[model samples]
Target chain A: EAGVTQFPSHSVIEKGQTVTLRCDPISGHDNLYWYRRVMGKEIKFLLHFVKESKQDESGMPNNRFLAERTGGTYSTLKVQPAELEDSGVYFCASSQDPREKTSYNEQFFGPGTRLTVL
Target chain B: AQSVSQHNHHVILSEAASLELGCNYSYGGTVNLFWYVQYPGQHLQLLLKYFSGDPLVKGIKGFEAEFIKSKFSFNLRKPSVQWSDTAEYFCAVSWDYGGATNKLIFGTGTLLAVQP
Candidate 1:
């Protein structure tokens, strides 16, 4: 089973530019989550996807940030008009059946994409 | 609002020395706790988790954490540290919503530097 994989390990964009980060989760995993860690801050959840539908997006910071998972497969997070504060590491994670009665299912994380918005 | 706090922002210790990092959470309801580690140039990895049962939970790499409900704390501990243990450690918490889709709340993180 392959771990979560992200694209463009690093990205640099202007303050007003748009950047999209992609995440390919483990095969058969039903849950996908997006998180970002700003400089000197803790990692914060952005949203979650169960299959192709978003289960929770309350964590999304603002209207400029959007996330989507098509066909219940890979996921993409788009940030438009990126701000200098958006420069940080974006991490993607996935987990197996979350509805199970067992202790919280462990979430496997990917090598985060480091985004630098100048 | 739920939040996690790590007491130490950075720590330096010699190899083979005992290690202990403090973590506290503010959520009053049931919650799950976890400790994650991220090495240089690597992603965050689970070091240990505590959901229920025994408060003292042992995880990979000889790491362990004790969950004290009354104290609202989940502190990571290791009997002996190794140089390879140098990394950033994050403490996280998730509300126990009966296995619902609860998001994780992470702490500011502590950078551990183990000297050889």
Candidate 2:
């Protein structure tokens, strides 16, 4: 099975510009999550999606950040009016059903997208 | 709010040397622990996890961690370090919030350098 994959491994954009990061999770996985690591800071959760419906978005920093999982397949995180602090690596992950007793259901991560805002 | 702390920001060791990294969390309920590693130019990957049962858990690549509930600690250890093991390690915790939603709280990473 293919691991989680992300597009545009690196992105550079000016402040106030809008940037979209894409994540394609493993096939048949029902859980998708987004996290980010800022400079000199810990990786923090952004949001989670379960089959096209957002399960939790409480970690989103502000109104300028938006995430979408339209068809329960892939996810997209969009940052509008990006600030300098938005520069960091964004990681996406997916896992099988947590309720499945047989499978450990560990999350598989993708090669993060490094965003640089100048 | 749940939080995690990794006491070491960086560690350097020679090959074949023993390794230990300290991790602690502040949560007053049942929790799951995890350790993730990210090598240079690579994505973060799971090194080990602790859900229940034995407090001592072993993972791939000869790594292990001991969970001490009383001290709220889950420390990673390895008997011998290898140059290829140089990477950034993050410790995280997931709380059982009594629902299907499971979120993780991560600590600032520790960069490990194994000298050859």
Candidate 3:
């Protein structure tokens, strides 16, 4: 089975510009997650989606960032008027539905999209 | 706030040398720990995971980690390092808050360089 895949492995945009990152999870996976890693910092969780509905979004940093998983297969993270601080690597991961398995499921990660805001 | 910490930011080891990378977390409750590896130009992959039982877990490519509940630590180890082992390693932890949030808390990764 194919692992998680991300689009535009690298993106460069001017500050205040808009950018969208896309992620396609493995087939049949129902849980999709978004994470971000700033330079020299730990990777932080952004949001999660169980199917088309969002399970938790407490990690979302601000209002300018938005994520959606329409149809529950793939996910998109959009940043409007991007700021310099948003320049970093955005990672998308997915896992099997936890309800099906008794143990916690392992997440498979994508190559990650490196976003550069100048 | 709960957090993970990797004490070694970077490490250099000659081939065949023993390797050990320290990881620790600050949470008193039950946690599921994981160690992930990212090779150059590759996706992040699971090296091993600790959910419960058997604290010492072995993973692919001859890597292993020991989880010490008392120390709140999960350190990665290898008896002999190889050039192919060079990669970035990340330690993460997750816990069920009310109903298994499943959000991973990761530590700043440690970059390992195995000299051939």
How well does candidate 3 reproduce the true complex, by DockQ?
A: 0.75
Provide TM-scores for the models. 0.97, 0.97, 0.97
How far is A46's C-alpha from truth in model 1 (Å)? 0.5
- Name the runs in model 2 displaced over 4 angstroms: A101-104
| Top-DockQ structure, candidate number | 1
Could you arrange the candidates by DockQ from highest to lowest?
1, 3, 2
lDDT of 2: 0.92
Residue A45's lDDT in candidate 1: 92
Interface RMSD against the true structure, candidate 1: 1.5
Q: Deviation in angstroms for B83 in model 3?
A: 0.7
Candidate 1 per-residue lDDT, tens place, A6-114, comes to: 9989999999999999999999999999999999999999998999999989899999998999899999999998999889999999998777766578889999999
Q: What is the DockQ of candidate 2?
A: 0.71
Give the higher-lDDT candidate: 1 or 3.
3
DockQ-based CAPRI category assigned to the predicted complex of candidate 2 = medium
Q: Which number leads on lDDT?
A: 3
* Model-by-model DockQ, in order: 0.76, 0.71, 0.75
**How accurate locally is residue A67 in candidate 1, as Cα lDDT from 0 to 100?**
94
Encode model 2's per-residue lDDT on A31-117: one tens digit a residue: 999999998999999998988999999999999999999989999999999999999999999997765544356888999999999
Q: In the order shown, what is each candidate's alpha-carbon RMSD?
A: 1.0, 1.1, 1.0
